[model samples]
Target chain A: MQFTSEQRLDDGVLEREFTLDGIPGVLWTPGSGSAPAPLILIGLPPLGLRKVYARVAARARYYAAEHGFAAATIELPGSGERPRWEAAEQARADLRRVMAAGEPVTDEIVDALVLPLVERAVPECQAALDALLSLPGIGGPVGYEGGVISIGVRLAAVEPRIAAAGLFAGSFVPAAIVEEARRVTVPLQVLLQWDDEANDRQAALNLFDAFGSAEKTLHANMGGHTGVPRFELEAGARFFARHLR
Target chain B: MQFTSEQRLDDGVLEREFTLDGIPGVLWTPGSGSAPAPLILIGLPPLGLRKVYARVAARARYYAAEHGFAAATIELPGSGERPRWEAAEQARADLRRVMAAGEPVTDEIVDALVLPLVERAVPECQAALDALLSLPGIGGPVGYEGGVISIGVRLAAVEPRIAAAGLFAGSFVPAAIVEEARRVTVPLQVLLQWDDEANDRQAALNLFDAFGSAEKTLHANMGGHTGVPRFELEAGARFFARHLR
Candidate 1:
């Protein structure tokens, strides 16, 4: 999606939607600013930019307004205007079956469902970055945060434009992602819920450990998958403010 | 299982089988040695110590014979003669389903399957440590290796009995295991196969990164899950010798 249209949201941020070759995305920019601003790219939660992740999704715009940063929320491949892939359906079915049977899942199944999306997402994010940074009021060395940490992991490894990343340790991570994380020299902040049933605790730790970053922190608290404390979110805001600001 | 039977194996190692309350296990000791030897506790692979893991199971005995160490191998809670828990059956079914459907599995399923075994195995390992240390040719500050790194991770955290550990980053690791690894200050060596499909790469990195051991080393190689090279095994043996011998 080329930078398509812009609308003023009630919150007063300039919300612009884009369709990168068909994939839909939204970029939030601080109102009344044509001056170049720092860019922050956000990957949405597992449910996409839905009710479950509205607050998280708003983080980009929040940074745009309060921190004088420009932020973008790109849709994952097979999401929004992009045609959905069969893998999502298959993954959903598999989850239903496994949950019903109450079985242990091998990583093989997970890779099949997620690896393609991540593979597709990485390039799309790069394209999104290319589009966003070229727009008015945008600059280089981007910041990234949110659920699709796989994209963040790969971007941090391969994309020099990403200055810093905050990864949500709440999804199925493959070995390739961890290996890629070893190449991530950018500063990182990983948020983990100790009792997150869906997230692999070891995997989260492994990704954090593999980071080549000289400066990194793991914000782990004892809670369910989405039960991150408000204080932690504020602390994360401070982290972004320190680095991205 | 409590220590019940002790027999001499053909290779001049005293073999003993135990059933701790309900769990079953075997211990091997250097033959004709009343001289207290440093202990090496072996954690079994996901595959129970059946014909599939016979060679792997002989590790403790080999360490005992070749290194003059008293070694013990404890069965996981549901292995050997112990009644398989419903959770284990559910986990197995789930793994099969996910493998068949070729879906990426959530760590929730892995946790559901492995967490109970790990929880039960940790205390049993502590008890095994207590019982084995009371026997002749047994000593404290032991070396631990192999799959149930969960037990190794836990024992390394709470049970000061473990002096060193050789962690095989080849199985499903829970979040608690990573948290426990953070508390593991004992000298440690971790083995990883770079392309292990079943193992989550990020989790392995997380667990390795979380280890608090100042003297820790990650012996990672390019191979599949079980394709560990002979030289690597020798290197691991050398690691154990340096720490336990």
Candidate 2:
């Protein structure tokens, strides 16, 4: 399937749109250069619609513009410009339909659906990655970033493409998956919500053990799972720039 | 500051510790070979003496283990096992102190703090970018993955990071300081409760817009800011795997 590209601006930043292998997506090209740059693919929560992800995409574009990099955000196969799922059940049913269509429920489907929907929308997350990789300047290798603020930590384990990742207010996947993900050959940055309710310190400890690497940094910020302290962004941005850049 | 390192295991994985300069920051290691891997730094939200961020750190470790990557989750300066904040107000004060102490707040700080906090936390969100320069295994340039999801499009202009991040739930900080935080160029991610009484999707959009590279991921798991979802662990695991790995 052929995809098209369009240009638009949110808050005075330039953004473009396109489809990837039939998936509707958007590209936020930093008017900088055309070299293959780092790409960040965002995952949506189960109840979240394409609009929410679009905000994230727009944010990515802004970041790219400022950082001299190219950025793109894509909607799921059946999301964004695609059909909508009115409720949890409807979303699940739609997922099932996608699976039934012989779509090869890869990591994207699992992230966008099963994990977040059933577990926390981890499985279906790959949809975003797939879309991001399909872009003109994005298909080489990729960096990974996310946090429990959206899905959780476990889903990150399943993605094999992430060379370096930064997680905020994040948690670990099941022990098995945690162990599996730890086997990935990438640099990782994790951000935790010190007062988070969903996952506690003990759980975070368990996750750390599962990772088993020495090149890791741990930072604590203020806020609950829903209330991370304000200072975290500075630390996170520094960390991302230092590592990912 | 001299940093130290130690190792431990939680759920059947190896975890490491890094002392900020030399304190009690913990790190999780993924992978087995005796090779130097890239480093990743994880950030956690603060709630003082709470184990919230700790759990997130552990999850990062688990992701490292599964992905065979070397990683770490660190505590913020004066957080976790280090000098701790006396209260949220104190924490905020500490932030100001850090800003003041740091090499004068430059355009970066202005981009990270002053702008987003003041202008948008309540309304209108700006677009940002998500770019990955590295990842595990897929060693190459990174690219875009998928479509965008714009939740609370109206709130796209609001800078939820430093201002009224969880404002919808009646969680408000001094609007003035929030405005100050808007200028900071710190990367932030805001998690909004779908069912929170104070949730204003429009405000969230504004928050997104103002926060620079902010991204919002919505979940319909049914709960308040402090409540855990039915599949919290399962979902969290998947989230980490997909994005972090």
Scored by DockQ, the top model is: 2
- Per-residue C-alpha lDDT of model 1 across residues A91-111, encoded as one tens digit per residue: 867866876798866677667
lDDT of every model, 2 decimals = 0.74, 0.43
Chain A TM-scores, one per candidate?
0.89, 0.64
Over 4 Å off, model 2 = A1-5, A8-13, A76-135, A147-160, A170-172, A229-231, B1-245
Docking class of 1: incorrect
lDDT measured at residue A147 in model 1 versus the true structure, 0 to 100: 58
Q: What lDDT is reached at residue A101 by model 1?
A: 93
Tens-place lDDT digits, model 2, residues A25-107: 55665665667666655444323335466446644765566654455544443444556545544546665787689674444
Candidate 1 deviant stretches above 4 angstroms: A1-5, A50-53, B1-245
Residue B198, candidate 1: C-alpha displacement in angstroms: 34
Give the per-residue lDDT of model 2 (tens digit) for B140-236.
1111110011212123233232221211211233334334435534323344443455444434434433443333222222355444333333333
**Quality class of the docking in candidate 2, CAPRI style:** incorrect
Which structure among the candidates has the greatest TM-score?
Answer: 1
